[model samples]
Target chain A: MFDVLTRILRTGICSEPLPRIETEQAANLQQRIWAVLGRALCIRQVDAGSCNGCELELHALNNPYYNLEGAGIKFVASPRHADLLLVTGPVSVNMEEALLRAYEAVPHPKLVVALGDCAACGGIFGESYATRGGVSRVLPVDRVVNGCPPAPPDILRAILEAAQGKRQALAAATAT
Target chain B: MAEFNATPDFSGAFANAGALPSNVPCRLIETSREQWLRVAEALRAAEGMLLALWGHDERDGGQGFLVYASYLTAQGLLVARLCLRNGDERFPSLARLFPCAVRMERALHDLLGVASDQDDERGWLRHFGWPREFFPLRGENRLQTSFPPTPEPYPFVSVEGEGVHEIAVGPIHAGIIEPGHFRFSVVGEKVLRLEERLGYTHKGAAKRFQTLSLAAGHRLAARLCGDSSVAYAWAYCAALEALSATVVPPRALWLRALALEHERLANHLGDLGALGNDAGFAVGLTQFSRLKEDLLRLNQAALGARYLFNFVQPGGVECDLDPKWATDLPRFYSHLDTELEQMRSIYDEHAGLQDRFRGAGVLSTATARRLGALGLAARASAIPLDLRVDYAIAPYDRMRTKIVTQDAGDVAARVVVRFQECLEAMRLCQRLLEQLPSGDIHSAPRVAPSGALATGIIEGWRGPVMVALQAGPSQSIRHCHVHDPSWQNWPLLEYAILGNIVPDFPLINKSFNLAYSGQDG
Candidate 1:
């Protein structure tokens, strides 16, 4: 216990600071959402159909470097309790209905962020005999983080952008 | 004792089994369909491990469907091929002799329209995604783009009793994990039975493989399972290299081994921490996750990819480690060693953690062997089978790997195995870096002749991952079967959770951490 405490003290707030949003519109929207929600955002992650590369990056958000929870963002177990839905991978045909049901279960005005290349434009495993393409094929995705597996910072930015209602601008910027 | 040669004559064992000269790790034998069961039985009786069973369509060439099963024996690897005459897709099922062949046979039936004579003919990989007539891997089926609407619910065997309540958990889980359905028949937290219905993540990987050249297939193979990307890529590359008779440089082989050990290290550290967190200790999760992140960042800086996906390619690796990074790797290991030692001490001293870990989910040795438990799970149960030692290839043959085992076969045993393996992997990385050779990193890609077959097997962190490759015209993949250790280990989880409380399921499951995507593909 002493070792852990001392180690934390030595490290002294090592979490990476949030990257600056280029657009004034995105910045203002983020500030407004923080003001309205008082800095707390609950997210529920759904794996529509993934190779688990995206999931690994998402899990790193909880690590000390990202410290997503320290920034008042928490991952919840149920979509009913979540304000945002984070979906990963191209929507497999078997998971299409389940993804839709999860979207329906979340409360109204739910923001959905698609993480990774697979969830963005179906990446390599495109619309095929077994897949229904990206998350947009099943749910209305507000933002799409691009990468085979997006880095933790990219994923964090997408979540924040989704919460701030600047998902369109975020998606447009990432698309290039 | 019989002398074990690299390639032995199987003609003496079976009358009609004709040996074919193929560029594979195993000796290829062509036999009639009637002789398949006899050969399989003979191999099993010789204590051969059934590595993979798959089938492919040959109707375009008028050769009908071909079923192949590969086995590993003391005499080395042996692959038996049998043709279903005149486009008749039915073949005798080897599942009766080898229980591990059950799912593979069903998968062949589902994807390739190959029929097995097994009693249980239910679709394995076909999870209502495509129509019954549309076999995805066959050359005839056109790939559909749209979604299937509201497929029928899978049939889970019902347990009718007075306090028998059923709990259905996910194709969408509560945690940030892959999608897999688990049905539990429980009476007040004590699980009577657990049935896993996976294949929700099936993306028709085999069909996709058929569309790519052998070089592009390595990328798809790496993505088959994220955590074991190195293993899959290396195995795929090995298979291609063997088929084309391309010898990878000694330095490239050493670097591949280093990358593989690093992959194992990252996964083991993450799993150890996750297991601790599942046992209700947040300290393990925090410390271990931090360690894992640091390692991943290091990997990113050194190898250009955090997951090491595109590093291993056909003939050789894509990137080579520079001298500076090579020297710094050992320093990184020392730092990690100190931190891991501290964490191990804490885990050992904590009584609550031990109570939750020990004896929670006990898988007896008898049950493990009977169910074909594999990799770390099998080692934890004293099975003592590791492909690195049993089927050594390249660098692994020179570097003697220490096999760790625990006879208890419980959660504690699994944890200990991970810790020990992590240390061993660290040692291996250090040795590989120290003995780093200066040579060309990759050899030129060689075009394999058409109608060639090769097999590559690697002991991935989870267990032995096997890739069987068959070349087609213009260097395209005719049929590539990527088999995960989960194919043999997933069934054992049902028995492992027989009497454990439902709450401990997460911890026990994390210990094994079988890949749903790998198995689904």
Candidate 2:
């Protein structure tokens, strides 16, 4: 127990301050994030058929440095609990049905973020007999983070943007 | 009867007929249909492990279809090719000798119209989108096609008993991970049998290779499994280099080694943390994750990418090690050593972590050997088949690679191996950095001789990542088969989980952490 404490003390807190995403919506995100998602944001990641580059970076968000959970966002096991679907990969034909089922399972006012170059636009494994291009080809993707795999900070930014964008869209519909 | 003696002889072609003591591998041996059976029996007796078994259509060349099997023995590597005429696409089965060949043969049936005489003909990679008659790899099929969905469910083997029930998981898992299905037959909490249905991530990499130039194929190869980007890229490059007869600069070779070691370190660190998290130890996750992040940060600062995707190319590595990297790399190495040591001791001493780790999902050495387990998992089970040490491929010949093994073959053993390997990787990187040669870090690229075949096998973090490249006309690729070590290790995961509780499945699975997209190719 003493050793654990010592190790923890030595490691210190590694989490950096939240990234400054340069956008009109992101500038006001800090003030309204809590209001938009109530208490926390729950994301369900569906890997359509990635090489797993994006998934690794997504996982990094949970580490002490990114501390995604500390910032009131966590990944859930079921799509039923999710406010957004964090999808990756180029959407292989084998995974198309399951992806749709997961998309359907998410509750109303859902946000979908395609998480890599493959999900945004089939990066290397393009539109083939096996792949259906990207996530947009199947479902309505609101945002796309485009690197071979965008960095963790970029992903965190996208998540915040997606949440804020969806909340505003719902408001617009009600006013109309 | 002249069997493959394994003394690799490399001339203009990979001459398998002659016997010579050479390090250059993928020694090609063309055998008759009848001779292939004899060769399989001989290789089995000689304790030669089948590295890869892939089938390709040669109808474009006015020949029939051909199946190639590459074997690694104590002597060297031998690639045996067997031909089947147009209509006669049947070949003898090697599943009796190497049980790992079952999945390969099944995939061969789906891709090319060739099959071994094995009873289990259930389609492995052929899902609803593929028609029964359409062989996608027959040189004339349009790959822009995906068939309509069919109403057929996969026949997963069931354990029928009084209390036997089933738990089905994923083509899309709950975790932020790759897709593959796992069917566990359990009685209450204890699992009786576990059968996996992979190939869900199959994006037809073999077919994609045909459309690429030999130079550009490494980009696709690097993403075979993004985690082992260095391994797949290196394998593809090595094969391309051999075919084109380009000797990479000594500095480039050293840099490649450095990148490969860093890749190994990054994966081991991540797996250790994930294993700890699985065992309900959050502290382990934090420390190791922090370590991995720091390493990746260094990679971005040095190699221009966090994942090292385009860092390794055909003739050599992409960028030379800058002076800033030379200083910062050593600093990072020392930091990793001290932090990793503290975490290793904590994991070793923690009774709760040990309790969950030890004796859970034990894959015996016998079972591992029989199933042809490779790389980290095989090493965990006390099988000393590291290609770096045994095959002495390139820079490994100079690094004085050490083989680390554990007797227990459980999750604990795998963890121990990971911890020790992380340190070993640091040691190797330090050596490569210290003795980094002063020369060009790349070579001039050239078109490979058409129809010439060769194999490049690298001891990747997971296992031996093998690339068998048969060049086409001009700069194009004829047939490229990329083989991941997960092919051998995934079957062993099924055996490892038997008799263990279903709750412990994730822990054991993380310990092995086999690749889906990599093996799907």
Candidate 3:
């Protein structure tokens, strides 16, 4: 609930009277902040063994139109330098232990966002003889961006949400 | 014929290798379960590479479970089916010959409740949180949650040294990638050895397929590996048609080829961009990504799905090409020509990318052959194992093809192979489109027999995709294993990452771009 409230505040949803900065940012400065954050993020992606659909869209994120790097976000090669984990595929029996180890490899204060329905719910590989059906089965999932393979922008939104720490389910909320 | 586009020849290679007997009626030959070790040795001596090992638990009468070892020889493919009687379900392990066979054996044990008497003590496919002894692939009635207690940390091989530091990375990573664990034995930044622990996403796709109809199973096949949707669908349908002795109309075959070429082009474009990004060429990333997007948009216009899902069915394709795009392809071809040339120049000019990609992650021809590396990895390294030329499948048999090869056997070589294939695929697509005949898109296939089994192999972008289907009593699928080339490559990746610095691992990995779900399935 608190996180929800925070998100609302971040979006300037609850500021009825509206602070000057909030209104201005909400009205016309969204792109400015996005541009700033875009250049600042360095992303890392994990396949866990997906069919390459989500990775395709993730590839599309770098297309001239979205120009993910122009926004300032770059796809890093190693988890050591990464801020987020982009996981695709339904977790499989062969990959479960590997997934956990990779999660532990990333430094502290890292984010994990499951991309596509397979990573979110195992998608079509669900109930198969060889898979666990979702990324959450192997690790504590932070946010799930669902689609067969989610559109690139939706993936960007999920990453943005994680960067802002909105995907964290707080202890207070859990305790309540 | 263009020298660059000239295909390689593999005639009489298998026969010369003596992998197959002079006369074998069926594609498969039966042998006792106990002969597995002897068969492995014999096949190895005969120059046959182990393709895959699959387990089936349908006890015919009291005859017990059947396990199959698929071997690819120079002449023709051969399968050795080993039958284990009901009470004795143990088989000798083949890990000694093929180091990768260990995991496939464990997968069979985990899914079918069978065990290898010679299996290494380390637990494999069962490491996922699934209940022990549940054996999800078995026809036995039981819930997945009701199996025995979970085992503690599985025993993985350990390396020890004074300067060797152990760097463990992911089943969940810090990137938008698949979950996999790699234990890197490193000194400073140089990696000595890398061991992978996967199976985090082990949904029982092969097992669940039993409940689906042939039509429904086609959908499952397409979903087996999302990026290789067309490949899986075609492979599965090909198996179905072959089993039913049904012939697909010429137009459907033409359409299937078209879908495949597009699929290949889309993936090559996307992977090229990712590879460029890995090498720190942001320009390459932007340019190639844009090109891929345009291609996918064209796909969306041609087929309903940008990824081309639900496009290929059992008998043929789900739909036909829009006449406009069919007519407008020349313009698309023009755009691709310009973009590819530009991208090629960027790659050629970028020294950093070349430095990182060229010598790094070199899987030599000897090692590649030992592991039976498939697809571009094999071709780029001079293994010369393309199914298009060797197996001579439908449209490919009728049409001319150039198998792109490079002897570098490194990241750069793999990238070069993909880029070159992009041009070849475009040419093939044009040939297919121009030659499409007028005919029905599909045909009603003959229903399968209860105990019958069939398999199909298609040359997907990643490499050879194999699908095995077994029919149950009610004509439902008994078991289906949608084997992706990743299974063969992931183990090789573990070896490829060795001797390179830890930081360069991602670029080496992206260069191959093996499918995660394909392996997980």
The candidate that achieves the highest TM-score relative to the unseen native structure: 2
The most accurate candidate by lDDT is 2
Residue-wise lDDT of candidate 3 within B1-521, one digit each (tens)?
01111212223223322222111112555665445565677677776777778887757456688888877766556666777885677887887887667778877887787787664655565673566656777667432332222547765677788887788877655556655677888999999888887665556666668767765787878876777999898888876776666778888888888888889998898889888888776656656767778788788777767887688887778888777766788679767976687668667766777888889898898888788788877887887777777777778877788899999889989998998999999888887777778879887777776666677888899888877776666657767777788878887887778889999998998888776567766
- At residue B32, give the lDDT of candidate 1: 65
Q: Model 1: residues >4 Å from true position, as ranges?
A: A1-12, A24-32, A166-176, B1-25, B144-147
Interface-residue RMSD per candidate?
1.7, 1.1, 10.4
lDDT of 1 by residue, A1-176 (tens): 77667666665666777655545443455556566665667898988788988888888899888888876688999999888899987888878778888889998667899888888977778889888778887778788899978889888777776766634443455587
CA lDDT of each prediction against the hidden true structure? 0.83, 0.86, 0.71
Residues B99-154 of candidate 1: C-alpha lDDT, one tens digit per residue: 88988898999888888888877777787877777788788875554546647666
DockQ of each: 0.61, 0.80, 0.30
Native contacts retained, all candidates in order: 0.73, 0.79, 0.64
Model 2 chain B scores worst on lDDT over the 10 consecutive residues at B7-16
Which of candidates 1 and 2 is the stronger one according to DockQ? 2
Descending-lDDT candidate ranking: 2, 1, 3
Residue lDDT tens for model 3, A1-176: 34324423443411122112312322223344354344355566877657667777886776666656654467887767766777777765565555565677777656788889888987766634355668887777788999876766677666655655621333223467
Tell me the TM-score of chain B in each candidate: 0.94, 0.96, 0.92
> Which docking band does candidate 2 fall into?
high
TM-score of 1: 0.94
Better of 1 and 2 by lDDT: 2
Tell me the tens digit of each residue's lDDT in model 2 across B1-521. 12443433222122345332223444666777777777777777767888799988897677799999988777667777887876788999999999999999999999997989999888888787678788888988977876666747789998999999999988877687789999999999999999999998888899999889898999999987989999999989888888888888889889888899989999999989999999999899888899899999989888777998998887788998897777788888998898888898999999999999999989999999888889999999999878889888667889999999999999999999999999899999888888888989899977688887767878899999988887889888998999999999999999999889989998999999999999986
Off by over 4 Å in 2: A24-31, A173-176, B1-23
In order of listing, the candidates' clash counts read 0, 0, 74
